[model samples]
Target: MFPITADWMSFVIVALATLFLIGELLVSTKGIFSILGLGFITIYFASFLDPGMFFVMIIIYFFGLILMIIDGKILNDGTLAVIGLVCMFVSVGFTAPNMVAGLYAVIGVFIGGISSFAFLKVFKKRQMWTKITLFDQLTEEAGYSSINQSYKELVGKRGITTTDMRPIGTVMIGDEEYSAITQGKWVAKDTEVEVMDVDGTKILVKDSEKLQKKSAD
Candidate 1:
């Protein structure tokens, strides 16, 4: 099993190495997965390359792993993650002695990457990923309600526009200022307007004078 030589063995070795390596990042395994991954990858590369070449390939593989971590923790985007997979595949492929073995190794990297997610279900996930990706629903019990909830209470309140309302401007209601929109009508600054409705955070308003004239009709 050490220093795998058969074409099919390339697939098995590469897959196991990738699975354990990525699993190490997804959940806490106390370094067992890391040791296993390093052992298998070292064996696969040592099987066909000189010592110098082996070191170069190993460095390339780990560089790919670093890119994946940076993408997840900082970018919160998948771009670097995809590039990392390509890097791992290339390292394994280039180390293989033949085209068939290279092809097998590349496929193994893809399969192992997808299977690593299974660790998330079986073990407690690493806490580092939670800060950027997971979020709790905001509720009153959490010491606060959603921001939109407070905006809902402002409906029917009268205020004066602090800026010209070319359908969108700022208004002062009592002592507080709010961004508001009119019904596609332009109103000069200092004109009185009433909050006609509130949809989520959006405040819809109409000129108070126009509203009273319509009520009189």
Candidate 2:
């Protein structure tokens, strides 16, 4: 058995290790929390444990962390994360020197997991966090963008009138020509105009001078 002065020493080590490990997983700390947590966890594993079983338990524990990362970051489904948490708690708990120590370890894990939530406000997010939340932002991308998305893209676009107009005329936007009209202002053929509005099939044009002055204001 590894040397330990008191039962509380295991609790402290487990708690600290669990805290830092969970913190590292939850947010980006540039690996500082991971290093510190790993150190404490390694120390805890080495103390009061059989050498032969040490590597095995550690593997089980780390495997749990990997599953969590996969679930939280990759899958975004809770299935693997739940299993991972169970694996981690069980591994740490079962490895303790006694039932009391085991209970402390499990409590430490819970406390660590709960407390790690606070880090969200202070730290930059892991890429996986995006998967877990605000998934509805994609609703804008799926079909809401619309075929007339180009209509909005046309806003402020520059075009030239193809034919003379008292007000209504054909305008060239890029290589493709579009039917357009000015705001009740007469314009001549080949004059440059900016898209003022597009409503279904109707396109409105503005003179460059008017558009420039309006934009400046």
Clash count list over all predictions = 0, 0
Candidate 1 local distance difference test against the native: 0.89
lDDT of 1 by residue, 117-172 (tens): 89989988877777776556667788765558768889889999999999899999
Error of 2 at 26 (Å): 3.0
TM-score of each: 0.87, 0.57
Where in model 1 is the C-alpha error above 4 Å? 135-146, 215-217
Q: Please, what are the lDDT tens digits per residue for candidate 2 over residues 17-124?
A: 878888898889999999988988888788856787888888888888789878866788899999988988888888888888888787877777677778888987
Q: Which has the greatest TM-score?
A: 1
Q: Which ten residues in a row have the lowest lDDT in candidate 1?
A: 131-140
List per-prediction Cα lDDT, in the order shown: 0.89, 0.79
Candidate 2 overall lDDT versus native: 0.79
